[model samples]
Target: CEQVTIIIIIINPGFVLVHFDISPASTDDPDIKQMMAGSTLRKVKSHSWKKHRHFRLLEDGLTIWYKSRWAGRGHSTFSVSDLETVRDGHQSELLLSLSEEFPSDQCFTLVFHGRRGTLDLVADTPEEAKCWVDGLRKLIHKSQTMDCKERLDQWVRDWFTKADKNKDGQMTFKEAKTLLKMMNVEMNEENALHLFTVCNLSLCVLEQHTSASLMSPLLSRDEVWKVFQDFSADGERLLVDELENFLQIEQGEREGRAQELIELYEPSEAARQQMCMSLEGFQLYLCSPHGSIFNPDHEQLHQDMKLPLSHYFISSSHNTYLTGDQLRGQSSTEAYIQALKRGCRCVELDCWDGPDGEPIVYHGHTLTSKILFRDVISTLKEYAFKTSVFPVILSLENHCGLEQQTVMAQHLKKILGEILQTSLINGQVPEQLPSPQDLRGKMLLKGKKLGGLEQRSDETITDEVSDDEDGEMERESVEDLTKDTADSNKQSKLSRELSDLVLYCKSVPFHGFEPARASGKCYEMSSFSESKVKKLTKDGKGSEMVQYNVKQLTRVYPSGMRTDSSNYNPQEMWANGCQLVALNFQTAGLEMDLNDGLFRQNGGCGFVLKPEFMRKTDSEFSPERPESRPGYRPLRLSIQVLSGQQFPKVNQKEGSIVDPLVRVELYGVPKDQSRDETSYINNNGFNPAWNETLNFVVHVPDLALVRFVVEDYDKASRNDFIGQFTLPFTSLQPGYRHVHLLSKDGTPIPHASVFVNVSISELT
Candidate 1:
């Protein structure tokens, strides 16, 4: 007799008294959730909760209260508790009715947790409601007690008996995915592999063990659960190792899959074009109409560090420098010459469309007819021809769409290509285009469909920006696809570029109010665009590209942090042509300290440093890399940092901590190192710990050296060392990527304070 059991999970709390603002997130049945939570639910934006009502957020489940008497005896506790009573018409009264159905001094609280902040309700009126809650809690706990293995075993035997109709042992990916969906985990290719590999890859290992293994082929149903029980530590679905195991194919198969996957990736050149045309990735917020084709006022900057621009500035809504004079003005040719004279490598040239549809130089969005492209080319040819390379980038302002902008970009690319080709024939941009794809290949379409955000968009309701912290998040997902194969060579190359740009790369500095994306409501829940629509849903977290046996970081990246649409990877974007991605430190509670890539043990700049690459076979990046895998090997780098940043934020939505003293964290730093040019300063030598206090001396160098640290890993001293870092030294090197940290170990405590003194010149 198949016992199809279902747990009776019903709401029994009678007198629900919520102190905070309560309302219906639902339109159809606005009163349902509040009614179910309690009989009397009070709500508003912020609640002035009263005495006698208490609230507490639990780690395991929800906590709520039911009020039997508004004037009952009880004192308020902390900031998260109830203090004043709130009445919001019928919702509160109706919600309080639930507590009316119960028997009166054994108080309990109900905490309703959503994706963001939680809601707390109190009921001190009746003791009956508390008793009911206690009973219901126990029931809920017992329902989840059945082990997955026991459950798996039952299903296996049943499936063997049923699918066997005659009982067959083998289950295909299709069958497995379906079975998993019924169990609540919707499986995709990577997810499926992750689950099977992470949970139980031994099934295919040389020592592959399963009940079927014991039987030497045809397996019985119950045996499946037995194997699950053996490997699962806490009986949780799958541990990280288990996930790794699921993808843990045999030596031969792993290599073959890597090769096949490599071919499926979008090319690097395609990615760069996608980024340029990727209207959303790099959005320009113009507070005022700019440039009418004015000559760029070229200024000189110190070129000791490899920052190519001797002196360049971008005019935006937000001023990059407090001192307006940090960046000077000059004509395009003069700016190009001055930059070249100062050993500069890159400069920004503003482009505008003229009335004739010809693109011309001037920092303006549009000119009388449209900027004429020929004028700018003539200017460059007459003056810049002699220089080996002009560290110049054409920044085109558009008042139109892809259909119109593409032509302008094409003209500019043509001009630059001709100019650079001449310089290279004489000596410029490294005779060979760094990555052929970046320079010669065509850009691919990042098939974007403009539509309303899907239902499960990341919620910003409770994730408000805080003044106390930078509010950034650490690493979201890590995909362990690095098993040795021939593609590793290519992947390594791309990863390095991506790593450098993300970690070491420096973005152009603007000397005006660059209207923040936040002000324009551009971002939805930290990532998705409110104006930009999601047409095709993908589930690889936030990733936009990926492929095997290729050396690009974008192809291997996991997914978006906030979206639920699966199967999207961004690794290929880096491998392709994209250069920059707009990221915010506030989202993760990290200040600008951990913003750069290479981490130091001097400041509380908790971030991922550059990752070391591995080649399963004998791997050394010599003159060139071998295209085929010499061996199939996997490598691991368990970095142990002595020190780094403190207060690298966590999701307050998760309610882990506002700014815990010693929280272990990790982040994803870029693989490239070309952008690392910064000064390093020595500060207090102490690291962060749970209780130990470390003193810091304040000092701001030109560039910064940053790092990330996780506490309580191994020894007693470990906690204090997590996220410790040093300030940048004045003697900075070119192409060095270090981050300037806040005043934790440095003198001034906050990052803004340190940054306020430095101009656009210091940061860029």
Candidate 2:
């Protein structure tokens, strides 16, 4: 058979189409090429906020177009790059409720975390859902590559906008060279001419052309179409076989999975039979929420969760009774609720005598208000195991008289019934503490023991004299605020009922590491004041401290200087293998951010497995003994602060902007390193491009948190925090990425982010 064929292409503001004919004479025709590069459409129903609508994926960098009834005019469009996540809707509790209400078989959701909130959709079957998820994962994984390709084009457009110095859409060769220099690119006559040619810019006539005659190097709409066509490949498209290869699927399951993905991503039967994926299809898949950091079926989720309790870094809270300062703050049960809800596995209670003879919890030697001890125990009973089933530690500082102490014990036994660890499990005295799995849904009490001395005449006389002078003060104050005096070494008596509950965590004085170990009381866990630990570490005894923490537990609390409940650098203590580095959970700052980042890993179960060297029974690794660990690699981290978006207002002035500077800190042991921009942008927080790079050499990456803090500069006082984001060094993905900033209360601030380029290498 003989035939003639012709091809045509159409371009408009809202859409682009390719039309071509094929015959025997031209079997390898333009239609095949068009099929490979052009956009493809599919009929699908989308629901955003309960409104079902029809949308299409356009070829312009994977934009989603809302079709309008009128031709050449569309409702609106959103780009795939704007999307943050796409995943199975069943994973969400809200959607799970919807599933119960509507009972759909196949459901998925797209999370455009920046502007567009979410797009929820339901398919006919689960098979379709799986295809959509897998295809979206593959496409989103390619977003980095796509960004790299488009970056240069974006730079060209931005340069044209900036270099049009007079805002007349034109620039001379000298002006172009100046822009190149600003971009840190070299330029010569040959390179300049080549750039002009590639960008479709014509050279100005030297004799007759004015500066206005020399036009911009920006591509016009038609020129943009031409560039797209030139870059588009003929017959270059993704096939099922290619996707299977990209997925690295095993041969046995390849055929079935590929068929499912093809159906999910390319819905049209014609496109499926053709065994090709159009550009538009690839973009749509990547833009969807198909990839996630957390997977329900991850192998780590099924592993044995049994280990010595001291072998994990438990998330703990300091001053859990107070919502504010230790001096004069309101003590409320809400503090306990908030701490428990945020995954705090341990809470502190400073028990003192109340007016009614009932024991109460409050900070001692301060005006802080008090709450009933029974109320705290009741709150713990209700919320201790709500967020997690892990064990909870009740760090009790008892300052009550024997009568009130007995009453406190009765309240705990009655309220915590069957859930309190009042005795050792299995009726055997463990040489070490039990595993978290062994104590799940149980609470353990920790407090000092009272002396059983028959005669207390000498000390009683001195105590009576002191009490007479201050009768308004409580009989005993929380010993945490009291320094260890000579009499502090004396063991005081404890009620048998309360003492039995202190089976594992016995609060004891930390005189020295050798004495603590030689005492042969492995069950005794000492709480060290932050200053004491710092002094010990500075005195070159950090190695001994790390070794002591292996078979026993050691807690480090904030120093007394932090009277306002602010936190210190937690990573400093964590690096020394301290088991319980308690922070003021109510305070929000860089210290808390670092603490949050370190605990964010290990599934946020409030238990992170200690590093092998730190957990070893007979190991020698320490902050001072770096030479003992041969495998410790020093990391060289280089971060480029590119720009920021959606910056919040710093002042109340109507049109006020922020004077923003980025502070990058490496929080770890040995020392914390910090470097901030010497100067800041005057009044532009949104899109303040510094293109500045900061570098750091880290000695302990495992215990380190890389903190990116954005602050509004203040010349007269400490800089005000705007927003910040934190993550462990190990979890960071190197290259250009966006860090979503979080507010003071740890809630994500939408549409707020810092664009950065990170490069990590081993420091020789």
Candidate 3:
């Protein structure tokens, strides 16, 4: 028999109660009295105005109150739906004043911001502070993951309250226009009337839908009344009590859990006493800046500093000087600035000799524009560690003469100052790459090394052409061609000072694994073209690359054919444990999306610890030889499509609804796979019940990402993307869950979700 555990949580003003059971508990008697006792539950304490208070974090909201018979006995509550941020006292000096009042070592401050003003409170102990912060963060995450219809209901109520300018339950046409402007929605009078008519108030529309009925311009349509009723309990105007119930359902509370929620998510005394939730109030709440999806006080949940540098994949940008394609592209240092700000740990700079004796960065053989190397260095100095304090790798491709190379070195050292890493951190090379934490805020220059000045070509011989007059010019040109070919055989190295800076990350050509290891310079790294590495992986040399990457860094770049700044699927490179998979960051597509998804797991810090098998020195795992594995299991994923809520319109006509279909994509080892819905629902945006089941089998589930994409079907053209949600296969929990839809830019869309029930099984 399989045993399942479920925990039910109740929140009252200033109190949180948790109850666990092996089976579902009856909600008929909510047991508010039992919850109020705070028995068999952990409690977090805070101080408001120097008075002791108890805080409860519920799924939908937060409550703080004093458990007393005195004047401050009543608790205060606010919905997390309108929460904008929860910041620590250290973030704001104003809040720190309260924290300073207690023993500095023992106390911390917390400030919760919602649509309403900030709630400033002090925790008595550091432990209490951490607990409140953690609890509130989890609740905020829970709120973000609520059912789409439920969240949309709260959103509708919130907007309605805001648009009702006169505190009356109805919004006038003038008020509706203002609300539209506030939402940044541009609609002409006709479009506005069309929307209002959809609410079934066309009875009030004139022939051109321009003129409104004279009496107050209030929408008194039955359809509008029905909407209010849907949000209210008694099929009438929403009261505070009814609003509470509406929120509880959206918060995933059980049917009879209303009373417990009422106490927990308390309204203001005036609103409670007034009882009515004016349409104006709903708009006020919905339009207000609720908390951001990101919590300012969220501690680093991923271990950023735990592993050696080689044990992670770094967010990297290729051809950092150019903003566009390799040919005829505009080169600017802004690309470097943008990449650094986007949490890229590695940036490449291709340096060539420029006019006026300055080194410039650009595509060496292309028609791309150029920026001075000094300018690139300045930009790097300003933004290198702004988004993340992790070490930055300056993958320098040197094509400059010795003089300009010296100038490049001077600019780097002068502008970057102490932040530049000129020597090994511990005065010696490490057996393993150092952790990003140990080299924080440091920039390491990676480029070719130059031999001593003795290796310089005889400068006089170039000017002294053959004495034969007629053949002198032609002979010089022929000799120049010969010299160029010979130059390819030797290293076009940097100045001695610059060469010293490339100590750890010296770029070397890759002949083969045995040659690289035998070179006796273990710090020398190689940047492999994507095709070269792919050939190695395909030719059964991936295991060797994996072992090599465990000790040294290897950068894999896009194939030369990708002149449009396109990207190859990076998972194939990552399968070899390649650390630097440099991509054109300016490009936006599925490749960029996958890159973002992978790095997002580790706090978006541009480094994600590799899997244990990849990081191990003695692992026998092989990407090309999966059949040699004895312990591998073939995994099956069964996902049941239940329904969609408030689907966003994609490529349909302005007033036409969507024909929604879902496509599931599995991206990882053993070739990326996908399955799309058999059929799409017609003319529906509210709710489309598919009740369909999709199945997938995978050999490497550990490295997989399951992306659920919703799209609109069109007979005349390609389907339009609605939104998508992606999570690692390992992170997937087998149960009924909501797939929250996100825009292409990764922002969550309100009231958009596909309800799904997932089950995973291992097949023999």
lDDT of each: 0.24, 0.61, 0.60
Model 2 C-alpha lDDT per residue in residues 335-362, reported as the tens digit of each score: 8876786678889988888888899888
* lDDT tens per residue, model 3, 289-404: 21111111221436647677888889988887776787778886656766775679999887889999998888766678888898788778877877788889998866677899
Error of 3 at 252 (Å): 16
User: What are the models' TM-scores?
Assistant: 0.22, 0.61, 0.60
Ranking of predictions according to TM-score: 2, 3, 1
Given candidate 3, what's the lDDT at residue 496?
69
What is the lDDT for 429 in model 3? 59
Give the candidate number with the greatest TM-score. 2
Q: lDDT tens string, model 1, 46-155?
A: 23443332233221122233343454754232211111122221222113333343211323333221111223334444443443344334423432342323233333
